[model samples]
Target chain A: MRVGIVVFPGSNCDRDCARAVAEVSGRPAAWIWHKDRDLGGADLVIVPGGFSYGDYLRCGAIARFSPVMEEVVAFARRGGPVIGICNGFQILTEAGLLPGALMRNVGLKFICQDVHLSVGDTGSPLLGGYRPGQVVRMPVAHADGRFHADAETLSRIEGEGRVAFRYCDAEGRVGGPSNPNGSLAAIAGIVSPGGNVLGMMPHPERAAEAILGGTDGRALFVAALSRAA
Target chain B: MKARVYVTLRQGVLDPQGRAVLHALSSLGFDQVRDARIGKYVELEIADGPRDEAEKAVREMARRLLANPVIEDFRVEIPGEGEAR
Candidate 1:
């Protein structure tokens, strides 16, 4: 399976995502520049983490207007698999590919730490390898990572089972102190209504290997790649 | 002409940064502060035109890129044209 990783001007985690894709699928990922309109015939697209456009005017606001995003949005509209992580997630929301906006953290501080997340709906192929209620570890680094939506939108997504993950304690209990960013409903991740696009705050690419201190994130890559194959 | 745009978090939306500032104010003995909210102010220099036309263009700009309608509400004011509703 071919994977395409989008690299914006200020993106710092593009290489990390490429490495994770290579490790999981045994193939180097194509690097698609933000200014390019082509996707390089990739079967799956990944929008990696980092402060795009130097986080100007909002974390992902400027990056959403990048030329490559036009193609990415088209790809997603055609039901192609798209995974947006961290700033990538922020971009997806800004681009209207996903619902809700990521607001500043409740503490008004940049937090960088490993957080536990309970797997929610695995209906999307990107998360098929996980079981419902399974807890996994991954690292989140951001100043604006709190997921917010109107009451009606929140209910609609929840009713449709679009939530992909929720912050939780090690034992899988959700809410309270375990909610790292104070995201509404403790949401850590969500998928598009078609179940093709996945947007999450945690850095799965940063935790996909045993040597990286955890392997819980490998399942997402493995499942996405295998499903495409 | 110059258009001043104010973008703020909509009512009912959480504003953590604003809350932090509120707490700091209270700690400094400014107990009269009931609530605080933070927002952005952007000034745009557009081509001089009719008052109505300039106001309309600035409002469009605010809707398109200056503010995210989902989370923010924006108000536009032209220096001598009064506030654009």
Candidate 2:
């Protein structure tokens, strides 16, 4: 399967995402410029991490209006698989491809560290390879990763099983300290109502290789590749 | 026309930055300050137009880009004659 990675002006993780995808799926990922207005027929699209447009105005706010995003939004609406990681997640929410908004971390600090994530929902293709309630370790780096939404919208997504991941301890317990960014309900990831678009603050690409200290993130890409077949 | 947009976190949403600022104030012996919340002030210079039409355009800009309705509320202020503070 061919993967497309969006490269915004300030994007720094596009290469890492491409390398991870190529290693895991054995397919060279294509780079889609933020101003290109084309996805190049990629099977899966990834909006990787980094401070796009220097995170101006708001995280992902400016990038959401980029020329490529119009096509990305259209591609997602057509049921194409799209995965947004870290800053990409913020952009997805800003673009209305996903619910909720990512606000500044409650502590007013930029957090960069490894975090434990529980597979809250396995129904979505993004988490297809994982069993429900499975725990994985991934790295998170951001200053505005606090997810917020109305209570009604939260409950609706919960009832629909759209939550793909949740912050938790290694033992799979959820609570303070483990919820690093103060995200509502400790939501670490979520899928669009269509189940085709997924957004998460953790950098899965940073953990996709065993040599990088973990291979847990490889399963997510593997699942997406399988679905593309 | 010139418009000013004030964006503040919605009521009931936690404002850590605001809290930090409040704590700092208290530490500096400004105990009389009951509470404080931080917000953003954005100024926009737009094409000259009728008062009502300019206000309408500014409101749309706030809703679309200046403020995120999920966690914040925004008010557009276009200074005019005979308007009370």
Candidate 3:
């Protein structure tokens, strides 16, 4: 399966995403420039992490207006599989491909550390490999990783079981000091209502290899790539 | 026309930066300061146009780019236009 990784100006994780995809799927990921309007016939699209457009005017705010994002939005509308990691998650939220917004860390500081995420809904194709309540370790690096939604939206997301992951302890217990960013309800990731789009703050790609200290994130890539096969 | 936009977190949304400022003020012994909220102020220059039209356009700009409706509220003001909207 061909994977397309969007490259925005200042995007530092594009190559990391590519390497992870290549390692997991045995296919070299294509680079889709932000200025380009096509996905280059990719079966899956990834919006990788990084400081896009120097993170000006809010993270992912300007990147969502990129020419390529127009196509990404359309592709997602057609039920294409899309995974947005970190800044990519921010971009997806800004593009309205996903719900809610990511706000500043409650502590008002940039954080970079390993965080345990409890898998919530694995019904989504991208996360089907994970079992509900399973805890996976991944690195989260961002200042605006706090997930926030209006009460109504939060209830709807919960009611629909759209939550994909929540920050948790190694034992899978949720909340408290384990919630690094002070995200509402400890949300670490969420999937679109249709279950085709998955957006998460943790660097799954960064944790996909054993050499990187863990392979918990490989399941997501394997599941996503297997679907295309 | 010159337009100024104010973008702030929605009333219910938490503002960490604002809280930090509040804490800093308290640490500095500013006991009278009760609350602090941080927001962005953007200034724009628009082509001369009808007063109502300019206001409408600026409001649109605020909605589309200057602020995110999911977590922010924005106000537009044209100087000498009486009040902000």
Candidate 4:
């Protein structure tokens, strides 16, 4: 399976994401720059983590208007799988691919560290390889990762099974410290209506190898390849 | 005529920068300041033309692109043109 990693102006995780994809799936992924509109014949597009546009204007604010995102949106609408991590997730939300907005941490600090995440569902192509209520260790870096949506919208997302991952403790219980960012409902990630698009605030690519810490995030790329195959 | 767009986060949306500003103000002994909301002002240098028409276009830009409707609000203002007051 081929993977495409979209590279925005300030994105620093494209190489790492490509490495993760290559490591787990053995796929020769291509790095598509913001000026490039094509997906480079890849079946999956991963918008990797980083402070795009220097997180100026707002996190992922300037990058949303980047030319490549238009093509990414079209590809996603066609049932193609797309995964956005960290600031990439914010770009997706700004591009209207995902629901809700990621606000600042309650403490108003930029959080960066390994945190436990709870896999909420297995039906999504993005997280199908994991089990529900499973906790995985991954690094999260962002000032605006607190997810917020109105109560009605929140209910709709949950009801539609669009809530893909929630922050949790090592024991798989959801709440503060475990949930780290004080995200609404302790959410970490979410999937779109069609399930082909996902926006997650955590950096799964950072945990793709055992040497880094754990390989729990590696299976996600593997699952994408599995489904693409 | 030139137009300006003001973009601001909506109420109930958390503004960390604004919170920090509030904290700093409180620390400086400004206890009467109950809250502070952050916002941005963008000046668009559009060529002088029909005043009403230019303002309309800037308003559309404000709604459609300048600000996110879900979390932010935007308003357009037209500056006085070439000695027209």
Question: Top model by lDDT, which number?
Answer: 1
lDDT of 1 by residue, A33-91 (tens): 99998999989999999999999998899999999999999999999999999999999
lDDT of 4 by residue, B1-85 (tens): 4677999998888787898999999999999999999898988888878989998999888876788787898988886745432
Candidate order, DockQ descending: 3, 2, 1, 4
Comparing 2 and 3 by TM-score, which wins? 3
Tell me the tens digit of each residue's lDDT in model 2 across A1-229: 6789999999999999988988977779999999997899988999999999998888988899899999999999999999999999999999999999998898999999999999976488778889999999999999999988889989988999999989999999975889999999999999998789999999888999988878888899889888876
lDDT of 4 at B11: 80
lDDT of each: 0.93, 0.90, 0.92, 0.86
* CAPRI-style class, candidate 1: medium
Residue range A1-229, candidate 3, lDDT tens digits: 7899999999998998898989987879999999997899988999999999999999999999999999999999999999999999999999999999999999888999999999996489889889998999989999999999999999998989999999999999998999999999999999999999999999999999999888988998999888755
- Summarize candidate 4's per-residue lDDT along A1-229 as a digit string, tens digits: 6788999878999999988878887666888888887888778999988888898777877898888888999999999999999988999998889988888887878899888888876379778778877888888988889998878889989988888888887888888678777788998999999899989998888899989887888878878888877
Minimum summed lDDT over a 10-residue window in model 3 chain A is located at A120-129
**Which docking class does model 4 fall in?**
medium
TM-score of candidate 1 against the unseen true structure: 0.97
lDDT for predicted candidate 3 compared with the true structure: 0.92
Q: Specify the highest-DockQ model's number.
A: 3
Off by over 4 Å in 1: B81-85
lDDT of 3 by residue, B1-85 (tens): 6889999889999988888899999999997999999999999988888978999989998888889999999999888655553
Interface DockQ per candidate? 0.72, 0.73, 0.87, 0.55
Q: What is the lDDT of candidate 4?
A: 0.86
